[model samples]
Target: MSETIYERLGGEDAIAAVVDRFYERLLEDDRVAHFFEDVDMRRQRAHQTQFLSSVAGGPVEYSGEDMQSAHDHLDITPSDFDVIATHLAETLVEFEVEEADRAAVMEAVAGYEDDVVTVAAD
Candidate 1:
C-alpha cells in the first residue's frame, strides 16, 4: 500500500509544527485574527494538530467539535475561509512538505469549507 500522507509528512511531530506555524500566521493576519480572540490558543493548537493528523491519515483521533457545529456561530465568510486556507498552505510550504502532500492537505481542508463558512446563515 502507498504511504499515508501523514507518514509522508513525517507524522504527528510535523503536523504539530505545521499547525503551530499556521496559527502564528493566522494570528498575525488581521483579517482572520478576530475569530480566535476568545480561543484558548494552547488547546486550539492541540486540537488543530490532532485534527490535521487525522485528516492526513495519522493515528490521532479528533475529539473536538464537528466542523459545522464548531463554526456555526462564528459567521465565517468564504473570504475568511480562503485566507485561513492560504495560511495553511503557506505553513505547509514553510515546512517543506512536498507539492503533492501540500496539495492533498489543502484539498482535504477545502472539503470542509461548506461546514466551516456560515455567512449565508448569518
Candidate 2:
C-alpha cells in the first residue's frame, strides 16, 4: 500500500461508503445504539469521513475539536470503543478493503482511545 492513507482507504468515495455501512451497523447494533440515538447521522457521517480522511494521511484537513474534548462527556467505555472498532473492521472487510489498509486504519484509531473514550462519572 502507498504511504498515503487516502490510497490505502480507497480515497474519498470508498471512505464514504465504509462510513455509511458503519453507521448502518451501528443503528442496528443494540449495544451501540444509545451512543448514537441522539446523533444526527447525516452530519456525523460527513464528520467521520473528513476525520478519517485526514487521519489516514489524506489531503483533506480536519479542523474539528480535539477528540478528548469532543468525547469527554460521553462517558464512553473501552468496551464501547472496541465494539465500534470491531464493527468498523467488519464493514471494511465487507467492502473488500485490503488487509494492509484495514490494519492501518485500526492502528490509527487505536492510538486515539484516550482521546475518544472517557470514563463516565459514577
Top candidate (lDDT):
1
lDDT of 2 by residue, 1-122 (tens): 54686876788888999899999998899988888878888999998999889878888998878888888878888898999999988998998878987898889889898798797432
**Which parts of model 1 have CA positions greater than 4 angstroms off?**
none
TM-score of each candidate structure, all chains considered together: 0.95, 0.91
- Per model, how many backbone clashes are there? 0, 0
- In order, candidate lDDTs are 0.92, 0.86
Model 1 agreement with the true structure over 1-122: per-residue lDDT tens digits? 99999999998988888888899999999999999999999999999999999989998888999999999999999999999999999889888999999998899999999999999632
Q: What is the lDDT of candidate 2?
A: 0.86
Q: Which residue pairs in candidate 2 collide?
A: none
Q: What is the lDDT of candidate 1?
A: 0.92
- Angstrom error at residue 73, model 1: 1.1
Structure candidate 1, residue pairs in collision: none
How good is model 2 by TM-score? Answer: 0.91
